[model samples]
Structures are given as structure tokens and as C-alpha cells.
Target: MRRKEKLVTVQLTGLTHKGESVGRTEEGVVVFVQGGVPGDKAIVSLARKRKGVWNGFVKEILTESQNRVIPVCQHFNYCGGCSWQNLSYPAQLALKEKVVIDSLTRIAKVSVNSLEPILACNQEYYYRNKLEFTFSNRRWLLPEELQNDVIDVNKNALGFHRPGTFDKIVDISQCHLQIDLSNQIRNSLKNYCLSNNLSFYDVKNHVGFLRNLIIKTNENEQALVLISFSEDNQSEIQSIFSFLKNNFPQICSAYYAINTKKNDSWFDLQCIKVYGEDYLLTNLHHAKYCIGPKSFFQTNRLQAEQLYALVKKYAEFQGHENVYDLYCGVGSIGIYLADQVKNVIGIEEIPEAIDDAKINAKLNNLTNCSFLTGDVKALLNDELKSKFGAPDVVIVDPPRVGIHPDVIAEIINFAPMKIIYVSCNPSTAARDFALFDEAYQIERLRPVDMFPMTNHIELVSILIRR
Candidate 1:
């Protein structure tokens, strides 16, 4: 007869992709706990069981890990933003390096010759250039509040969603992710809405005035604020925008959109500018980029410079190579390297991003760069090669899901002399690397820590055609 276990105390030895700690039972059954760190001996209550795997939550900390430190953020546990805040910075980098190596070795079955050390960020906190906060009518209550029977707390929250709960939000007093002004803007807006009797969005019923707030800052200290409203109230919208413009003089641009759809996505909805310019400016080395409302730019501006440096170093451009940049958003990478390359062609699926890319190229005064709007898998064919000239080098900075297999096939068919891949997700990158194992040999692998105090890591891989 098999033994049925209720609650088990196990020793955690490893970490997972989503920052969960891994442990095993005496029977060698793997268990995952959210708050467990490596070298932690904790009492966990198994909450879920499936097949041979078990999931648990930490009930009590029997023995804390050496790498564990007191998280600085007050909203560390409840907020879904940063999970590894308890772990030290050095420890986080080490674990991220291990994650990359493990995924490549285990999932891709490819042996990397040289795995360089992770490039740590100089500014860990307040490194993000962009942050999005949701306005929720249902606020998640703290354990202490529930126990003390505190019912006078304000129910409206303008902050991040609670972990594993979509409708509930944790009211954030301060967020260490973005600049301090972000907190000021969000809190002020929340107060203004409350005072003015403005209705915050209820995700369940989808009825409210305020839907979502997006804040972005550039290297020049210029700020852009974009708000989404579920209902069309021009008076309220103008009042809020005017208040922001008058109070926060740093906010150079302000835009608003009315999104009545069940979802909060404002990509398809038209945004109307109420103040200042329509776009914010960002720079990478010598190249300047104009970031529009829907443009996709790297959230970590400083680390992005280092990441692109590695990409340029690995590509080894000699001013005569024709380069093709796939999944190019705003032409940041391509424009940065255009001066050193013969000519560059960038392809992106989003039309707005392509427009920004073209505008950025023109702003940089690079006549050798061309931006095209289309699906890469459908665009990279014999005709494209004939029109744009065969690429001497190809650079791919794909999404977290990695590139489509058909797109990989097309790249292989084109057979560029060199391929530089920049990925935010290691597992998907490893899987994609496996597809190129037959034709390309891995030359260099460099991991860049774009996001500190979190489990997310970025990597740049250089492969040469065999």
C-alpha cells in the first residue's frame, strides 16, 4: 500500500523558472513552494498534487538559507512584481547563470563551449524605465488587517494585481521597480479619484472610469503618462491630464484612450494626446529613438545598452556586412549598428512599431537602414533576399515564446555567415538553439542581468554557420 502524506517538512535545494523553490520528499517526490530558497529547511503544507508531483506553501521556516536577506520592499510578498527580493543580489545572479546553463544542457542537449559570467546591473532598484499599474475597486487585505477586523480601509487600489488573483490588487505605498515619481503620480491620482468620486475599474463587471495607468521615463528624465478609461468622459480625462501636467512638470507627454472592450488592452484603441509631444525620446550610445505610445522599447534602458554592446561585439561587423534584424521593435539595435554596417533591414509585425523604427532611423540620419512591417516567417523568402540582398549576418531578438519554427527554417535556408540571438527567456532560447545545432556552431554565450531582484535574465548567443 502507498503511503498518503498530509503535510511534510522538506529541505529546499533548487529554484524554478518562476522563482519557486524545489524540494523533494523522503520518497523522492518533487515539491515546489513559493517562498522557499535554496538551503532552506521549512515546514510546507501540500496544497496540490498531480500525478507524481506535489505543490506546497511554506507554513513555517525551520531553517533559513544563508543567501536569504530581509527584502527591502514592503510589498515584497504580496505583489507579483519581484519574487527573489529575499535572495541576495550575488546569489540571484549565480542562480540565473545556473538556470541558463541547465536549460541549454538539459532541454537543448547542446554543449556550450564558453558560458560567460552574467553582466550585473549597476542600478538594481529604480532601474525600470516603464511601469503599468491597474486601478482596482477590490483591494487585497493583509493578514493582520483581516485578523484585527479593520473595515475602515479604502477599498479602491491603484497598484499591481495580487499574485494568482486577477480581480484583487495590493495597494502599493511605494514600488522600488521604477523611479520615486511613479509612486507619487499613482498615489496622487488615486487620491484625486477618491476625492472627486471617480469610479475605479472593477475587473469582474468591467464598469468604471479609470482602467489602467502607464508611466514611462527616458534617459533624458522626460516622462510620458498614458491612461486608459473604460467610459468616455472628456471632462474627467482633461482634468486629470491638466493636474498631472501642472504638478509634474517632468511629464512631457500625456495621452488617454477609451477602451470599452472586456479586456484592458489599449493597443487597438486610438490614443489622443492631451499635452506636450506625442512621443518620448531615448538614446542608446549615439543612436536616438522616438518612443510612441504603443512602441516597444526595453524596460531597462541602462542594461539594454550593455546587452546591445554584447550583440555588436558578437556580430563583429566590419562596415561591409548586410544585416537583417528580425522582430525589430523601434529599430534600436539596427540603428545602433547601422553606422558600422554596410546596410541594415529591420522587420516587425506591429505597424506602429515599424513606424517608430522608421522615424528613429531618420532621426539618427542613417540612410542605410530600412524598416518593413510584416510577419518575419512570411517575409523571409527568396524574393525578400533578392530585393534586400543576401544577409551576411542576421540578428534575432524574439519574444519570450521564441521564434516560429518556420522562421528558423527560413534563416537556415538563407544561411547567413553569422547569427546573433538575443533572448529574454533561456528555456525558449535553448530550444531554438537546438533547432540550429545541425547547421550552426555556438561560438559565444553571454547572459545580461537586465532585471535585478527578480528571476528574469537576458542572454545573447553568437552562432557561426558551419
Candidate 2:
């Protein structure tokens, strides 16, 4: 016989990397509770062990945390995008700050002399410049709809994937992360598809015509859309594109792709443009970025500008320093600091990002900035340094895994006077700080809440040569 279900009452006190609340029982057995606030006393069900820790959700809240607040989105209970929305914005900032401090003290085991307060974002919602939606035939039923209700004949969904479920998606009526235009366009497309009998993608069998929709909005109030279809059906594609143009004039450009592959990865696929303009434009301070269909740019515009300002202030550019931007995707940071520096040389692995970087530099009429496309670890050598000159200030914005140890050794060998490290993962950043202990010392560190209502954070630290 199957074992009987067991329940535990846990006092949720902290957070995990995925935004679940961390709690403990009387015996100090740790519990990760979903739908839990930091200070909530909740009865957690679905109690199951996974890799030695208990994972569950709050079945009943005996006591509410002071930091708890009403979530703005109706689907907050189930949607995975904004798990911290129920927690107050101030509380969210505090939690992120705690992540940094804990990682440094426990993991890095280094004492930072100065750590600034977390910089809160201006907007709590609608701060994202881009959003991607998937089309799935398996839709996750709502709590109310599952109570002795029959499954509807229609099984169409066009929204985010349900948490922990790869095949099923939650049909979103409204999303709060992007502008209202995004909402209208998404809803209109879903309705039109259902009415016109265009089938949604079947993840299990890899059958159907509709696959995905991506919407990118800009500070200039123009929108760009990309539709991914399972196969190339020209007549149907034109009909859909025509419908979009007739309904939403804000869509300045549109593109569609034919993806016959099983996976949703589109970087290798070709995207055909059937609309106006080649890219979207975003003005970041003095630099105007041309964000193409596949280019990577900062999602939060307001906070990105503030973060760049911090980079400039921390570098303390003297107008005669040669700067090296390592892993600089699209050269956003390097180009922004071009005017204040003698010359800036950027290195990145992706050729497309480097192409965009060069385009952006030329667009801004910046002769001092140049970009190279190659693996940072392979390219940061004596030959490259001799060609571009030794860096006075080194700026690195690596992936979440942080800089590899080999790359760290090379940066130390360069022996730049100043180092600026921008990180998205605090834990990895802490690990990296430990590696840099001997050569450089962290002068000052600041955390920016680039993604509000979520646990994701960005931090910029200035390191001085010891």
C-alpha cells in the first residue's frame, strides 16, 4: 500500500535561490515552503524529502508576516515569474541584501570593508522590456476550476509554463511584468488563434503549427514581435501577420520563424522579417542602442542607467586610462564609459553580440571604443594586451557561474590598477571574491534591485590593487 501523507508545521523565516521561503521546525529540520512570507507561521503540506531538505507549500497560514502584502497579479499564487510579489517591496530588498551578506560571510569568508544599501528600482511592475510566451495544448487548470469540474474540450494556452511542469502552461489573462500593449497583443493573438482553429503546440508529440511568441518593447514606445511556428505555412503566416498589423499599429516590426526542431532554442534558427525596421531603439543616457531581433540588452532600462552610473563613479575615470571590458556583451558598459576614458577595448565570445556592439559604437559616433569577438579566457593574453595596451581599469560582467579560475589568474597577471566586477549571482560572486583575495581588495560594493518583485539581483563591486 502507498504510505500515508505526512504534514509539518514550519515557521518560514528566509528564502532559497528560487524564491521559496526557508523555514525550520522545533528540532531544526529545515523546510522550504511555497506561498510563504519570511515571518509566516504556516502548516505545510506536500511534505517530501529531496536531496536531504523538505519541500512543501503552506496549506494554512497560522500567522502572517509583517512584510506580507496583497499581490497585484491575480495569478500570483501559481505563476512562477513573480514568486515574491506577495512580499512587500521593501521586504524584497531586505531579503536580497541578506543573500549578499550571507554569501560573503559564509561562502567567501572575507570581510568587506564597505557594503552599500540595496538600490531599489523605481517601478515595481511593468519594468521588463521583453517577454516570451509559449503555446501549449496542455493548460494548467485553476484551483477553482478543478473543484468537481470537467475539463473543457478546448485545451489551448499561450502564456508562461506552469511551475515544475514542462509540458503544461498557465493561460494568462493578464501579466504585470510588461506594458499594457503587451497584454493586449498577447490576448488578441490567443483569441484569434482559438477562433480561427489554429492548433497549439503539443510538447509530447511535437505536433501543431503555433509554437511561441516573443514581444520586445522599447523606451521609444515602439514594439517588436517574433512568432515561432512549428512548420512553414506561408498562407497562414501571412494571415496572422496581417491580423497583427491591422489590430496593433504599435508593432513597428514583426518577424516569424519556422522551427521544425523538438527543442525551443531559436538562436541557430533563421528569423524572417515581414515587417518594418530591422531593430528597436533604446536610449541609455548618451548611448542609443540598436536592439536587434536576437541581440541581448539590459531588461530594466531605468535601473540599468543607474547601474552604469555606478560603474562610471566607481572606476573614477581620469580621461587618460585604457579600459578593458571582459565578457562585455554588446559593449553596453564600455560604450557608456567611452567619453570619460582614453580608449576602451571589449572582449566577448558571441559574434552576434560583438556585431551589435560595433554597430552601437558606430551609431554613437564613438571612436574610442572597439570590440573583439572571442572567448574571454582564450583572448586575454600577452598578444592581445600588447596589441590593445595593458588595461588601467578592468571591467568584467561574467555569467552567473562567475569567472573561471583560469580567467581570474589572467586578470591578476594583467595587474590592472582597478577592477570593476558586475555580478548577477551573489553566491558565485562571493566565491570569486575569495579567489581574488591575494591581489585585489574590494573597496566598495553596492546591490541594485534591477528586477523588482523578484529575488533576482545585480551587484557592482570596485576592487583596488593591493
- Per lDDT, the best of the predicted structures is 2
Tens digit of per-residue lDDT, candidate 2, span 333-426: 9999999999999999999999999999999999999899999989999999899999999999999999999999999999999999999999
TM values, all candidates: 0.96, 0.97
Which 10 consecutive residues of model 1 have the lowest summed lDDT? 1-10
What overall lDDT, based on C-alpha atoms, would model 2 receive against the true structure? 0.91
The C-alpha stretches of model 1 lying farther than 4 A from their native spots are: 1-7, 25-29, 49-52
Quantify all predictions' global Cα lDDT against the true fold: 0.89, 0.91
- What is the alpha-carbon lDDT of model 1 when measured against the actual structure? 0.89
lDDT (Cα, tens digit) per residue for candidate 1, span 1-466:
5346478888999987888899976667789887778988888888787576788878788999999988899998789698898888999999999999998899889886667888999998999989888998899999799879899988899899897787999988899988888888888888888999999898898788888999998877778899999988889998998788888998998999899998878789998899899899888887788877778898998998999989999988888999999999888899999999999999999999999999998998999999999999889999999999999999999999999999999899999999999999999999999999889988999999999988898999999999
RMSD of each: 2.9, 1.5
RMSD of 2: 1.5
What does the lDDT read for residue 244 in candidate 2?
96
Candidate maximizing TM-score? 2
Name the TM-score of candidate 1.
Answer: 0.96
